[model samples]
Target: MLRTGEQYRDSIRDGRRVWINGERVQDITKHPMFKPMIDVRARIYDMAHDDATRDVMSYEENGERFSVGLKLPYTKDDWHAKRRATDTVLEDIGGVVTRVGDETAGEMWSLYDGQDILNEVDPRFSTNIRNHIHHVIKTDPFHVSANTDPKGDRSKRPQDQDPDMLLHVVKETDAGIIVRGAKYETAAAYANQAFTKPTIANWGNEAMSDYAVGFVCDFSSPNLRFIARTGFAGRAPARDYPLSNKFDEVETLVVYDNVLIPWENVLFYQHTKAATFIRATLHRYSAFAFVQRNLKLADMLIGAALWNVRQTGLEHQPAVQEKLATLACYREGINAHLTAAIADAEESPGGLLMPNQSLLMTGRVLACSQLHHMMHIARELCGGQICITPDVASFEDPEAGPWLDKFYTLNENWASEDRRKLLAYARDLLNSDYAGHRLTFQLFAQSPPFAHLAAVYRNFDWNEALRFTHKSAGLSDQVWGDKR
Candidate 1:
């Protein structure tokens, strides 16, 4: 079920409810801002067919070949290998920042969805679970997992809010259930074929039964509409802003107006405990996907920073050399965590490989650290050029051309215009709203920093290390609590 970019585009072009300002988008593909993002995502599909990336984008299984996506590996080694493959694919594409399709979101979603149903299988439902996996692999449909409910107030329960504020089963028919409500900030929803679950909502004891449901449906199924995101970043001109042209991030409000799902697609309904259990477990595995995403972005930043060092003719300066070293350290730290987690994966009950939780958690904790430091290093090494550089268009102006050429000139090692182009790219990243938006999302999307640290403190076993230290200090290991 390999989809070309255009094929993916045409699938979602059926007049979804997309509005910016006051007008609804008639055609998402031709929309000025949305088109660039679609094109970038198309390139990701094209990479699968590319000679350079084909090896990384696909893998061999049982004498047959399959696309290596967010695939569920049969063993721990295969799991790490998949991560390596994801990194390689992302590198060839220059990074994972702007595009919608990077294999992380969909691959993991399918894996978790399959595992959830398998966990509670009676013979009949178990067979249904297996069939869904086969269907996904054969069709290779695009999927986005919707977990966040657009809560009216963070403190209130789903029942406390207006019932319509939450997405819940409104009616159960012999055929399937009908769902109404919305999920917001659904990344890749515009191009996805379906949405998967554990629904993230406060289903108080009373609301639990109706809310604790998981299922699948076609993206183009009746009564669904996408309210596309709008702003300077989303609406920037394509020709004038080449980087923004493809791979724009789209946030959509997925409105489910009485959508129906057949009996087979319903994984959990009326089992509130099962829903919570599935949510906790999936959150654990999603750490692997996050590592894949962060590593890809860090690699891109490293390339940009190194190029900036040379472009500014400061590559040899002591200060610049030190900044590059710090940048390299960030890259090495993230890769090291990912490597260690892979090296220690354990097989789970549901026939899937799970990352070592402590190592994976450590990886999550350090994730933002690496990114923050990369931004700091970029500022130190790149200089004001990232913020003050002239636009690519300035060269076209007769009055500005002579001054642009004269002042923008670099040393004999590189042409001034060439240097300017690279700096301009960095400038767009650092000086524009893109940088701030990234920071906001990074903090906003994550749990509180202290909550993460507390999990690390509680979940990791430090007894072995503590015993070793006490013995090294010439004290008996007995000073410590039971080795058990």
Candidate 2:
């Protein structure tokens, strides 16, 4: 079922403990640091009910309306609808915000595809994942992902150092399993639940371990604390840092001190195969949305750069045009991957339609790996004015205002105020503290760069290339006989 903005707001007011800037946030819905993102999420919910957006944002099933973002995929049309819904939200919000529900919900779908691996541990585990997927659709709660434990020491085993360094099943009780550890999660402070899981890729020969655990963590449960990074909203004026003030999806280090995960919420446990399978295939479905965000980011870069050049009347320069063309290639490269991924969509092991794995994985690499260079190109196009611009307050000052206006105004059409606003926007998009954090966040958020390559390696058709090379070289059939 669908929820309204106010209902979504009231749901998260469950008195969950959240700390930021050394102060306990009294109301996340009202706090300056969190309220912006919280309102964005709320607006997303509201969009589903609005007359103009309802058709695009939700689907009807059995006489009940549900969020299109949470609906299980069955056909190519479903994916197109999901893409449109996400794009509509981005356009409506006027900026990119990744961790809002849709992008993270598909992580659960990946586990749902691994029911066979889950069944080896416990049949109930498979059942739990299926139930939770439907529960998300039925309840329409704001969900996020939890992976990447603090993992204190790389050299020492978790047992040697602090055992709680990695989140593990500390105790199994009749009521539930109590976990103790922390995870770096974006939007956890305001999100309703998380599909908590392991990040370990290699299990070696070991079988059962405490770290091999996955569950749905209810944020309101006791013994949970959300310690968020200080936000950019209240620290600076919105006029000076537009994107930062409205679009920062605050990251949190969530400490789970003996938190309980009931049997119904547990998706898997004590199974290395389940953990390994999840790590390898975690982004199979979710990467589509993640890479889609990069596409939107690319658009932002292109728009900012092109507008800067247009304002300066450098749009006709061959050199400037070439850089713009490069940005377009980057944007379209991502567009091609996303579009083809859907056109050549494949059915998951669980019978759900997912973006073609090879295309999607490679697209993620292209989008994320080249983002920094793309940002640099855009920065170059915007020139030096973005970084050297004076603050809005300085422009408004009695003594400095006239001098700043005289220097900043380019023509009658481009006034000093307009120039100042553009530079402020470009600075926030590429040079502010928020800009650096966003870059790093995109770099490692889904997984690290190496993991992106590893995914491509696993999904790409290496055998095809090998067979073609063997045929072209006229290798003997005996070479393949032994391998076959």
Candidate 3:
């Protein structure tokens, strides 16, 4: 069922204990740093009820309305609908937001795809995953993922360092399992729940271990705290840092001090195979949304760069046009991957339609790996004025206003106010401290570059290349150990 914006705000006002900037966040919906994103999330919910967006954001099933984002994608049409819903929210909000409900809801679907693996571990565990998927659809709770733990020492085993380094099942109770440790979650502070699981670990040696556990952690549970990174919002004037003020999806280090996970919420437990399978396939569905964000980012880069060039009449230059083309190519490259992935989508083991693995994984690698270089190109195209520009206050100063206005005015089209705003926007998008953090987030957010390549390695059709090479080289039948 769909909810209104006010309803979503009231839900996160559950009095969950949260801290940011070394102080308790009494009300996230009211806090300067958290409010913008929370409101954005709420607007996403409200869109499903608004007359203009309701048709796109929600679907009718048995005369009841449900969020298209939370709908389990079983048909090609379902995926198309989901894509349109996400795009609608982004366009409506006027910027990109990755951790908003739609992007994260797919992580649960990835686990849903692993039902067979989960069933092998325990039938009840598999049942838990399906129920949670249904729960998301029915309740439309804002779900997030929790995978990475504070692995105290990279070389030392979790037991060798601090047993609590990696999140583990400390104790089990009839009511639920008590878990201990912390996870780095992007939007857990204000979100409803998280699909908590193990990080990348050597789990094959263990047949049974406490570290192998996965559950849906209700954020309102006791003994949990969300310590978020200091946000970019309220740090400066919104005019100076538009993207930072509104679009930062604050990352939080959530500490679970022996939190309880009820039996119904536990998706997998004890078995190493279950943990391993989840780690390998975690982003199978979620990566699509994650990479889609990069597409929006490319657009932002191109827009900022193109506007700056046009303000100075550099658009006619071949060199400038070539760089603009490069950014466009990068943007469309992501578009092509996303489009073709849906076209060549494959059925999951659990019968859900998944984007073609090779394309999706490689697309993620391409989108994320080259983000830094693309940002640099855009920065170069924007010229040195983006960084050397004066503040808004200077432009408005009585003494300085006329002088600044005279110089900043470039022909009748571009004026001082518009130029200052463009430079400010470009500065925040490309050159500020917030920009660096966002770049780091893109590189490591959805696993590292190495892991992206590993996914490609696992899913790519290597046999096709091997078969081609064999035929081209005319290898003897006996030389190759084959069924033929």
Q: Please tell me which predicted candidate would have the highest TM-score against the true structure.
A: 2
Instruction: Give the least accurate 10-residue stretch of model 2, judged by summed lDDT.
Output: 475-484
Q: Report the C-alpha lDDT of model 2 over 292-396, residue by residue, as the tens digit.
A: 999999999999999899899999999999999999999999999999999999999999999999999999999999999999999999999999998999999
Alpha carbon RMSD to native, model 3: 1.1
Q: How many residue pairs clash in all the candidates, one count each?
A: 1, 0, 0
Output the better candidate (1/2) by TM-score.
2
Give candidate 1 regions above 4 Å deviation.
Answer: 50-52, 60-65, 97-129, 198-207, 231-242, 444-459, 462-484
TM-score of each: 0.85, 0.99, 0.98
Q: Is candidate 1 or candidate 3 better by lDDT?
A: 3
Q: Which lDDT values do the candidates have, in the order given?
A: 0.63, 0.94, 0.90
Let me know the TM-score candidate 3 reaches against the reference structure.
Answer: 0.98
Candidate 1 vs candidate 2: the lDDT winner is 2
Error of 3 at 479 (Å): 3.4
Query: lDDT tens string, model 1, 61-174?
Result: 576455566456567766766676666655655545422433333334433445545455334444555666566655545555565566677576666878757778899899
Best by lDDT: 2
Specify the poorest-scoring 10-residue window by lDDT in model 1: 98-107
